[model samples]
Target chain A: MARHAQKWRDAPALNSGDEVNKASQSMEARVINPRSALLSNYEVLSLLQELEADHLARTKIAHRIKKEEEAAGTDVSVPIGGGRPSTAVETLENLRTVSFEAIKYLSADHQSTTSQTPEAVTELVKSLESYGFTKAEKLQIVNLAPQEQIELYVIVEELEDRLSQEQMVEVAEHVKKSLAAAPSLSIVAQPSHKPLIVKADENWDATDDVDEEFDDQGEGAGVEGDLDMEED
Target chain B: MFNLAILKDTVAVHPADFGTPQELAIMTELNKKYANRVLHDVGLCICVFDLTEAGEGKVRYGDGFLWYKVVFRMLVFRPFQTEVLLAKVMSSDHNGVRLSLDFFDDIYVPIHYLPVPNAFDPNERAHFWHASGDAEAKQTELLDTPVTERMWIDKGEIVRVRVEGDEFYDDEPGPVKMAEGVQVVKEVQTRAPFTIFASMAEQGLGPVSWWATAQPEDGEEQDEIMEDG
Candidate 1:
C-alpha cells in the first residue's frame, strides 16, 4: 500500500499536507464523504477484471522478453507491473468461467437478478418512479419478490408515512407484474442497450441487500434509463 | 471500466457434445471452458463475445475428444492505475475496513490509508475520522456552506477510492503465513483472489456523501436508525 501511496503522491494534484502525505505511504485510506457513491458488485468486479487484465497483459510481455533474453544467455528483468508471457496465439485468457464463478459466489439464481435482461430492472425502477417508488425501493421489490406488503415493508421500512401498506403492496405487485409482462421487454425496451458486457456479478447478493446495508453511491445515471414503455 | 479484449483459446468437444453443429459445439465448449476465469496478466476473461477464428477439430491423441482451436473476444475488467472507483464497506477490524464491489470484494483500505487522525472504535466496530483537514481560513468560508459535516466512515459506508496498487503475489505462503505447508492467510487465498489496495486519503476521493450536496438518501436514514437502535 505504501508503494501505491508513493505512486499516488507522485501525482501533481495531491500536494496538501505532510500528514496526508505520510499516511499515503502508510496504508490504504478510508473516507466518509457522501459524494462517494456506492459501486454495485458488477461495477466493482468489472474493475477488478480490468485491473487483473491489465496486470496480465503487462506481465506477459515482460515474461516473453525475459524468456527471449534468457535464451540468449543474457540477464533480464521483468518490469514492476509485469513478467511472463506464453504461446504465440495463446493470449492471456481470463476464462469467463473463472469470472462467472465470482459472480455466482455473489448469487446463483439467474431469475432473481436485478434485471431479467439487464435493462428491465432499471426500467422498472424508472417507471415506478412516477408511482413514487424510489430506485432503492423498486430494486428491493424486484430482488426480493416479496409476496406480501409485510415482506415489501421489511425493505422499505424507512418510508414512514410516504407510502402506506397498500401502496407498498401496490408497488411490489406492479414490479412483479411488469417483470412478468416484460420478460422479453429488456430486449425490446432498449434494443441497443449493452449491459456491462464483461459484467460478471449478477446483482447485489440477495443477502447483500446493497441499499439496505451498503452505502451505495446512488449515481442517478446508473442502469436505469428512460425508455418508451409498451403497455399490455 | 469494462472493455472488450481479444482472447483466443482451444476448446475440446466430448462425444456427447459432438452431435451438435461444429460451431455450436465449439461455442458451448468455449463458454464452459472460458467463462469466469481470471488470468493475472490479461484480466478476468468474461463470456466469449464472438469468435474471430475457429479451426476444424481433430481427434487428437487418445483423449477421444475433438479439439477445436477458437479465437474470440471476451469482456474484461481492467482499470488503469489511479482510476477513481467506488467500493462498499464489507467488514471492519483492527486490520482495517474490508471493501467489496459485490463480485470483487477483496479491496482493503488500511487504517493508515484512512484520513489522518482517524481512529477505529472497537465498540462500534467502525472507523471515525475527525474532520480537520481544511484550515480555519477555509472553514470560515464554509460558514454558510450547505455541506453536511461528516464525522466518520462506519461499516457499510460507500466510499470512492483511488486504485493505488494491486497485491497478488502468486507465490506459495512463506513459513510466516504457512500452517504446516499450507497458506494460513484466509483473506488472500480464499476471501478474494485479488486484493485491490486502494487509498481514500486524497481530496475529492472519499465518501461521496460528504462531497456531494445531494440530500441524504434512505441509506443514510437507515444507518442512523440502525445506529440508534
Candidate 2:
C-alpha cells in the first residue's frame, strides 16, 4: 500500500534494511514526472469557453441576419446548415461540462495568477524541489497547507515509501509550521471578463455581455482590459 | 459500497509450503493473487471473504508445484450511479474539488456541479460557493460579507458526494529490461485502477456541514439513508 509496485514477489522482502533502501529507490525510478499526469483541465476549459462564446456570438449574428433577410436579404446561413450549434459541438460541450465538473480541482488550471503575493508560494515550491517533490506536487502542497502529518501523507501517499517515515513526518511538520507562520489567505478578486474572440491566441477577453442584443460595433463589452492577462 | 462477488482462479502451491495445511497454503496464495487488484467486471477486490470450494491440488508435470482451483466470494467496492457517499475533500483547485474515501481517492466534482454562484479563489487555491438572494450573484463573496451565503470547502473537510459513474483503463504495457541476466518488467503506471466520477451537484451533497445542519433537502431523510463507507 505504501508503494506502487503491485507484484508482491517482485518487491524486496517486506521488512529488511535492504528492502527499505530498495523501496525508496524503486519508487523514484518507477514514477513519472507529475507534469505528464496533468489533465486537459485548463486547455479544455478555455477551449469550451471559446467554443461556446464563439457559438453564441455566431448565433447572434445568424439571428440578426435572418431577421434582416426577412426584410430584404440573402440566405448566408444555408451553407452553414442550421442556426443552432452542431450536435457534435453540443455533445462535446456536455461531456466537457460534466467531465469538467467531476475532474475539476484534480489538476491545476493553466491561467497564471497575478496574485500580489506570488513570491510566497513560488519560494515554497522552489524549496520543495530539493526534497524530491515535483512542481505539481509542490504546488499541491502549497495549495493544501496541510495542518497534520496524516493529511500531508494523503497527498504524497503514491510515493510514500520513497521517503522514510521520519523524513515524511519532518516534512509534514515543516509544512504545518510554514503555513502557521505565513499570512492568512487573502481574498481573491473575480477574474476579469475577456472577450471570447482572442481566447485562443493573444489578448483574449472573456466579457460576460454575451447577450442576444449584441451590437457589431467598436468592440463587444470593452469595460476593462485584463492588464495582467497575457501569454506566458 | 460493499457487495459480494464470486471469483474463480487457479493457484500455484510450492513445496516450501508443504508443511503448512493445504487450506492455509491455498488461502495465502489466493490472497496474494487477488488482493488490492481491480477487475473490470467486479470493480475492486477488497478481500476474500468465504471460499465456496478449494479443489484438490494436482501436481504439475515438470515444476515441483501443485495447481489448485479455488472458488470464493470476495468483498468488492463498486459505486453505482446515484449512490451517495461520505468522502473527505482531498484538495480543491480552480478546476473543481477532489474528494477521497479511505480505500479509494479519485473522486472529482466539477465547477458546474458546485453550489450556485461559486468562484475559484486563485490566491487561496480553493473553490467557494456564494449562495445569493439574486439569481445572478454579481458581487464576489470575497469582497462582500455574506457569511451565511458564502460556503467554502477547505482541504480535509468532510463532503458528501454521489457516484455519477466509474471508469476503468487497462493497464498499459511497461518497458522490458534485463535484470540479473534475466528479462525484467518495469510497469509503474500510476493510473488509478478504479476512478470514480462523482458529483456534489445537489442540495444534500456539497460539504456535509451544510446539509447536516440545515433541513434535509428534497425531504428524503438523506442523512440517515446515506449508505457509505
Q: Pick the candidate with the highest DockQ.
A: 1
**TM-score leader:** 1
For model 2 the interface RMSD, in Å, equals: 21.9
Best by lDDT: 2
Q: Is the docking of candidate 2 incorrect, acceptable, medium or high quality?
A: incorrect
Tens-place lDDT digits, model 1, residues A1-232? 9999988878744554554564345233111121112223333343334433422332333344445567879553433344322211122244433453444432333224423434455665566676576544454455544444434444453554777666666676766765565443222223222233212122322223323422322222123231111000
What is the DockQ (computed on Cα atoms) for candidate 2? 0.02
TM per model? 0.45, 0.43
Candidate 2: TM-score?
0.43
Root mean square deviation (Cα) for candidate 1:
22.2
Candidate 2, which segments miss by more than 4 Å at Cα? A1-232, B133-148, B174-190, B215-229
- Looking at model 2, residue A98 earns an lDDT score of 32
